[model samples]
Target: MLIDAHCHLDFPDFDADREAVIERARVAGVVRFVVPGTTRERWPTVLALGERDDVSVCLGLHPYFMETHRDADTEALARALDAHPDVVAVGECGIDARFAETLGAQWSLFDAQLRLAKERELPVVIHCVRANDQLAKRLRQLALPAGGLIHAFAGSPEQARKFLDLGFVVGLGGAATHERAKRLQRAVKSLPDDGYVLETDSPDMPLAGHRGERNEPARVAEVCRVVAALRGQAVERVAEASTTTATRLFGG
Candidate 1:
């Protein structure tokens, strides 16, 4: 079974046909999805989705929407986790270098989530954009107990190695499907068999040929195929290894 290790299925983008979207993915042999929360307001929707058999949830404050976050959101996240012990992890949280103004706030929010993940013994599903080095440094300072994933990893092999050494698996999504992402392709090829997981950050990172269209979970199969070709391994082997890695990190 293929698992989309990171996706935002609760977002309004799929309101019209979320069920149909899930069905298509199921038909394509994608059995499970890990949906991460972006902000406090979206937590309920994410939690509701987690109640379904096919979904797992990770709650956190996303850096991109820094203005929407409140000072109390961090405590609220802790309360939500305490109230719902079944939550799989603690994030889609990390710093975004692109948003210069929110960098400081992002660090505080990310640190709070990391502390909560440690306290609860859960893994994290991180969202990092152009902040890999800083993110890696923080992870080294405050190590995760259950480990986690670095979603949509597009870094050099050296950077990927740092995250792997810190016990975090690199998540490869539609970004790697592009021929222009040779560095990421090389990282995918050279990563340890157990160091990578497949994802399709749907409604966001479109594949090479599917630009401008809304991405979906079914495309994870294509992601696996791309990773397989990059690694010179069979698609089934890639599927099995990634599935094992995901199951070990977040469970089935």
Candidate 2:
């Protein structure tokens, strides 16, 4: 079985046939999913989804939606984590340099989440984009006891190693399947057996041949195939390694 280490199954895109989507993923050998909450307004839906035996949940404020988050949201997140012992991690949080205007605020929010994770001894599920170096620096200084997963990682092999060295794992997904993503593919090829996990980042990051359509957990099987080909390993091996790493980072 495989786990979609990161997927937004709570998004409205799947509201039409959510169960069908999950069934398809299970049929395709993707047995579990990690769903992360992006905002306070969405936490109810995110938490509700966690009721499933096959779904794990995480809560945090995403940098992309900085304008909607208030200063008290971090404290709210702490309470949410306390109230929900089933939450597997403390994230969907990290710095996204693409949003230049909210970069500073993003750092503050991300830092707060990191500290919360440390205090709770829970791992994190990060959403890094164009700020791998900066994020890595913060992670190193904090040295979270439970470590974390850098979801949908698209950095170089060297950068991947930095996270691994800091007791974290990089997540590989649809981005690594594109033929033009030579750099990311190289990073995938160089990853150590235990240094990476698989994710679909569903409702976004559609795979290569399915670019215009909505992505889903079912497609993570294709991601495994591509990653196996990239690393010159068997598909089953990639699936097992990634699932193992994901399970270790975010318990069932």
Candidate 3:
């Protein structure tokens, strides 16, 4: 079975047919999903989704939607973590250099979640975009006892190595399925067997042929196939390694 290491199954995109979606993914060999929280308001819905046997959840504020966050949301997150013993990690949180306007607030918010994760000894699921160096520095500053996953990772082998040294597993997803993503494909080819995991980031990062359409967990099977081909390994081997790594990092 494959683990979709970063998906938003709780998001409205799947609400109309969530169970059917999950079932379809199950039949397609995507047996589990790790859904990360995007806002304080969505935490309850995300928590509800986690009640499922096949789902794990991470709670955090995302950088892309900075305008939706309030100062009290961090406290709310801590409360949610305390109220939900099953919470697997502390984030979908990290820097996003693409949004220069929210950079400062993003730093503070990301730091708060990082600190909470450290205090709780939980792993994190980072959402970095064009901010790898800054993120690497912050990770060093607030070291986590349980390392994390860099979701939807698209970087050089050297950049990935930096995250690995800091005890993180990079997530490979639909982005790697494209013919033109040579750099990411090359990075996947060179990644240490245990230093990466598989994800779909469904309802978002659609694969090569599915652009402009809603991505789904079932598509992670295609992601697994592509990654295995990129790494010159059997699909089963990739599934086994990614599942083992996912269990190690997130423990679902």
Candidate 4:
């Protein structure tokens, strides 16, 4: 069974047939899922989805959603984490330099989430973008005890190595599907299979051929094939390594 290391089943895109999407993923060798909450507004939705036996969930405010975040959201997330023991990880939260203004707020909230995760002894799920260097530096400063997942990792080999050294699992997904993504493909190929996990970032990041189309968990099989080809391993080998890695990282 494979693990969709990061996704948003709570998004409205799946509202009409979320169960069916999950069922299709299950049939396609995806036995476990890891969905990350984007904001306090969606914590309930994210946690609620994890009520199912098949899904494992994490909570955090996404950098991209900084505009929607209020200071109280941090307190609310803490309460939610305490109330829901099933919340296994701390984030899809981290710095996103892609937006300079919100970058400040994102770090403010991201640091708080990291502290909460450290306090709770739960792993983290990072949503780093154009800020891996700073993210790595801050994570080092905070010294998080419970490592995490760097979702949809599209960073340099050096960045991947940094996160892996910090006991993080480099999340691979549809972002690596593009033929012209030679750098990402090379990084994926070079990354140690033991420190890597598979994902689809479903309802987003559709593969090259499927660009402009909605991505789904079931389509992760195509991503698996892409990873397999990059690693020069059989698809089953990719699946086995990723599944084992996911089980170890999330204990699913």
Candidate 1 lDDT, 65-110, residue by residue in tens = 8999999999999999999988999888887888898788888888
The Cα local distance difference test for each model comes to 0.93, 0.93, 0.91, 0.87
- Best of the candidates, lDDT: 2
Give every collision pair in model 1: none
lDDT of 4 by residue, 1-252 (tens): 688888899999999999899999989988888888998878888888898888889888888988898879999989988998888898888877889977777778888999999899888998888888888888888777878888888888888889888888788888899888888887898888797999988899889899799899988788899899888999999999988988887776
Q: What is the lDDT of residue 130 in candidate 1?
A: 96
Model 4 has an lDDT value of 0.87
Tell me each candidate's TM-score. 0.98, 0.99, 0.98, 0.97
Report the C-alpha lDDT of model 3 over 84-161, residue by residue, as the tens digit. Answer: 889999989988899998899999999899999999999999999998887888888877899999999998888898
Expressed as tens digits, the lDDT of each residue in 91-171 for candidate 2 is 899989998988988998999999999999999989999999998998988999999999999999899999999999999
Query: C-alpha displacement of 122 in model 1, angstroms?
Result: 1.0
lDDT accuracy of residue 176 in candidate 1: 97
Could you tally the backbone clashes for each prediction? 0, 0, 0, 0
List the candidate 2 regions with Cα displacement exceeding 4 Å. none
